[model samples]
Target: MSNLISGRLPAGVRPQSYTLDLFVQLAEKTFSGRLLISLKVEKSLQTITLHALDLIVTETQLCGQEALVSIHPSDETMTLTFPETIPPGEQQLSLAFSGKLNQQMRGLYATEVQGETFAFTQFEATDARRMFPCFDEPAIKARFKVSLNVPTHLTALSNMPIVEEKKVGNLKKVTFDETPLMSTYLLAVAIARLEKREIRVGETAVAVWTLAEQVSLGSFALKVTQAVLPLLNDYFDLPCPTPKLDLVCVPDFAMGAMENWGAIFFRDACLLLDENRSSTATQRRVADVITHEIVHQWFGNLVTMHWWDDLWLNESFATWLACKIVDQWRPEWDFWLSFQEGKAVPLALDALENSRAIQADVKNAAEIEEMFDALTYEKGGACLRMIENFLGESVFREGIRRYIKQFQYQNASADDLWTTLERSSAQPLKKIAKDWFTRPGFPLIKIKTSGDTLKTLHLSQQRFTGKKTGTDLNPWIIPMTLKYEDDESIHEQHILMDKQEMDLTLPVQGSLKWIYGNASEAGFYRTAYEGRTAKALSEFAAKALHPIEKIGYLGDLWALSSRGDHPISVFMEALCHFRGDASRVLVSEICSYLEILSRQIVLPADHSRFAAFVDQQLTPLWKKCGWDADKDEDDEKRLVRADLLWALGSIAQDEEILSELPRRQTLYQARPHSIDASLVGTLIRLCALSDGGKRFDQFIEKLERSKTPEQRDHYLLALATFNKPALACKLIDLCLSNKMRAQDI
Candidate 1:
């Protein structure tokens, strides 16, 4: 290959369509393929270059003549040098190549389940080159026609449904229908001995595929899809992109899920649910993962991102919209409250000195991989939520609908989306949203009152960093809301804070109890209240604030205290005000914060004091919920019970919880399903930690009998919790051995 030094391929020729035929040999772990690509040559040239990695090309033919091929490993490109200069017109390039079915969970890989080998593909973020030779960039959209030859007993799946199948001796050739114009990264294929459970959502055929023994485990996922698919269709104002949709649960997957056009791939843990064994958290996770991938069929598959730099446009929209759809479907689950707690992760990451922008300039494969972090998914989603709250939900929904309709089956940039939204709402969006998209950090709003009555509020904004920096920072155009309680009633005021500092005078008849910025936890910024205001808000938060707002309040204070903006004592003092709160979301957050403090901050000499403090806060709630789940209890109570059990047994070291572990373990051993599914894992871990080497063999026996993926995970994690040094070493060796799946290791 010619020594091209650029990170991206030269753009003289583009692929219009591809016809790929492959013979997969699962036993030998290798595959051979012939690729016929229809190309549109933009300029007359003697040579053409495209991406290929770890593949051997046996033959190359162009225009019915032999073409010279050279492979460049440095840039993962294959160059074709023709005998004569090709004209600027349509042409066909043919190549026969072979590659190994890699063990790595990317490209075309092999995974073993129940002593059977299956081949799967994961080609996003530049791994498509590892699978086949092609223009493996997101902007080069092309139609694909794929045909796979596999053993007769195996089933073949791709981006489209199988159009034809023919048996030839012991092998079968499966040809899929041609796909819509799409990016190469969205192409997928699977060959496995699989069984599927199918259903119809509107005119679209939907199925969940799994191994035969686990086929029944997909019932919950099927139910979730049956509800979520039509909701998204109506919301987007479009039909499903493809006639059929398949959600496949693979034994080995690198990510939570991959939205590969019509065929999505998920890890078994993310897709399968054992109703008798899986916890409420697992059910919630299954719904979230399924909904997230389905949303991609419209946002990321139908309307693709132009390049890697705009990856957030595809991922953030899917992340934000999935939460919206799932919350609507299961409002009783209080899903948005969980979302408010989840935002704390990205907010903390953004406060660091080395944080990257929501939209960073990606130059190479490594940079592209770096883009798939908390900043892109969590922070980006939070930014979109802030925008939606500002623009009004209906107005934002209309703008998104227009965006998808305008750019379906094509590539678009972040600017294209912003422009479409601006036109839909007739609002100036680009200027207000530019900093959030391009800047590295978020703003921290500090409040100060001028008058003794506290009606006149002065707010200032600056870039918040975990550590001090000398660089000058630019101001963000913030959409803010203040929720305050006066003597008469609660009131909300909305403002667009575009300047460095702004002042507002509240019109109140009586004294104002408190003013809370970041109302409803909608904005993507942190709020810092003055001393007396912070105290009063914390004292009255249960009565005055929504559950979601309470989570946001605690999360912000926890983050600020961790970064040394305030003392740890301040957060500890605030925790005392919520002792009797019944919201599971708030209680769970409090437990998590206390656990972290116990592990990372409390001194050994003062550990008992801290444990006593935790017991004082959670014991009454634990007594109310009890160790066993009540038949008439709500999901929130069950979840809160699980959280409290974990905190008391693991962190607080409460003697009542510790002494009851043996009895709980005995009861679980007697009848596994009799124990509360949500608390089983916590009980196992605590028992293992408390019993140590005495019951190691018994725990091992229980692990060997584990049937579901969730059970296996709980056992494996419990095995690691044993406090003996010898047991720890044994666990290390067990992980290094071939007994466990790569994902578990």
Candidate 2:
């Protein structure tokens, strides 16, 4: 007991031996005197000697039908007991365990797509041990020399460049150029029977590896990076350093994408594309995510945090940096608004939930994985964006650069990140960061407007029981992006983060029409202005000053109304004004909220009034905009057609509307186009509404059988409409469980 070694397990991880027993009573058990294992590592001089000592393998998970593993330790070098069960191992294991060699994982994983097999590994922290035995901790950073015993027909790629490849027997031993000493997780390997599509982005050679069945999708994967990489290099003042960049799409990907240094692993949908079949939104989303993961090569993988608690340091910084580059890369996309609305809103929601805080830890790791939802990733990312808005870009970038350099090849906490910012600028960045990350919920400002004068007030979490009190104000250092309209004039405030109340005396400010809280992509909360402000936003959302602003306003209004904040009445009023001119996404959200409200409160008699408003609002757009209804089989025509049909179907049960489904279906097939997520969801709703699941399943069964992960995601949504909360939640749970693979959902 005196000589035993132990370390506290971080959240989301456990020690290899968690429950060790050491007592006289346990003497009968397998010998255990520390069972100390040591390893010597060198990147330049390829070698690793694992001194297994006496660590007995009890109830082993390794050495099954796939492969066998055993280790016999000696003073000279531990001999790996490899299994001859697999044919490749018989020939390859001798060289794979070549004394001057190593193995690593993470950032990429290769698998068989169709008949083509590829090698890809995701070795984040302890998982890297699966690839090869090592210290298997972030703190013990080391450069690795990898000697891969791959099949002769397949190509092996890793971080940095490939230095040599030689054939022996049926196996090819490929050695990679040495990488900088960094965490084990940054070590990536992608080997496949893949053809490469290469591009020169400055000094870096960008490559896309695709299996025969996926060559088409892989072609479009790097286009987004081809454009954004250069922009980011200029912005970050750090060129993409790896000699080669490779992206491989795996059919059975568990995560969206991994930012492996030099080699990246992506879900098929993220990398593959066909213009004829995909929607404009999907293209934009692809670009945005590409920007996000690529930036992580520098921010997350290249310079990573030491431990799981500081995971936010790597993730949130990358999350914000992606938005920063995306803004400059694709100005037309206005993806930042999506970050604010989609990312920030959920963070605020989760912070308000029972277990708040961006960096929450529980006794076990399974709990941590559960928290790794939209709130942790997206919303946490958005708050990081807000911090940048407060600190300014030059300061933020300098802070980031300094932080990376300071902690390069090591782990870092959120505090370490703020320390750089604090040193760079004379600001209390730690306090500012803590206020947002450690605190629960977002700041909501409630301002009262009167003619020619506006009385702005902070929205403290005060109980409103008739009598009012703005006394207990915890004024968030909020960067409120406000749009002040004076007559026909528009004024924008880029900075004004901390204030309980702002009193502005503008000439004839009479009844301020639209006052949004988040302002632009700068703020991190929703606006709650009902009377004239809501009316004005509803009227002006389509032609708003900025597309991003329009996106935010729509999201805020919808979320506030959906959670029963004000009333369903407000949504109806706002939808009436917004129906004619707005983004299709905005229109879709409004319709979603209206349907929920209709189900919850709107009586059958009250449905027509609200239903008519929906029809009138969406009609002009359906007629003139991209979402014109159709029954053609053409994918392009059907996508927009499906959206329009869903809007119509929501108002169905009306005899005339019910009769038009067959007509719409026919027209949709007339001009055949590929179906999309929204369209598929719409078709499902229509089928369920018309008691057409059996009929719907007839068409959908084939698609389901041949569906990719992305398509299967939509199938789960159709199942989500259980019409009962308990049942809907149960189905959601079922879909998430391991019983059904996430990709098959």
Q: Per-prediction RMSD in angstroms?
A: 1.4, 9.8
**What does candidate 2's lDDT look like per residue over 1-745, in tens digits?**
1111222212221122111111111112111111112122112211222322223333221123222334533221122333332221111111121111111222233333444444566765345543444444555555655656666777777777878788867667777777766666677766566776788889888887766655666555677778888987776577776777888765566667778788887776677766555555566667766777888777776677665555665667667777777777766555565565466346345534353667765332344346556656776788877777777778877887787677765667777777888999778877777867776566555554554344343332321111123233576666555666655567666555565556654343444555555656566665666455555656665565475666566555555655657665665665565556445445545566656666787787888886776677666666663434344434333434555667666663444556765655556446435334345456555655565444443434534463343445445555554354555565567666544543555
Worst 10 residues of 2 by lDDT: 18-27
Find the candidate with the highest TM-score and give its number.
1
Give the whole-model CA lDDT for all candidates, comma-separated.
Answer: 0.88, 0.56
Least accurate stretch of 10 residues (summed lDDT) in model 1?
Answer: 466-475
Candidate 2 Cα lDDT to native: 0.56
Question: Candidate 1: where are CA atoms >4 Å away?
Answer: 1-6, 468-472
How much is the lDDT of residue 606 in candidate 2?
80
Which residue runs does candidate 2 get wrong by more than 4 Å? Answer: 1-119, 344-348, 351-353, 362-364, 449-452, 455-474, 494-514, 529-547, 550-565, 599-610, 626-642, 651-691, 694-701, 704-742
Residue 374, candidate 2: alpha-carbon lDDT: 61
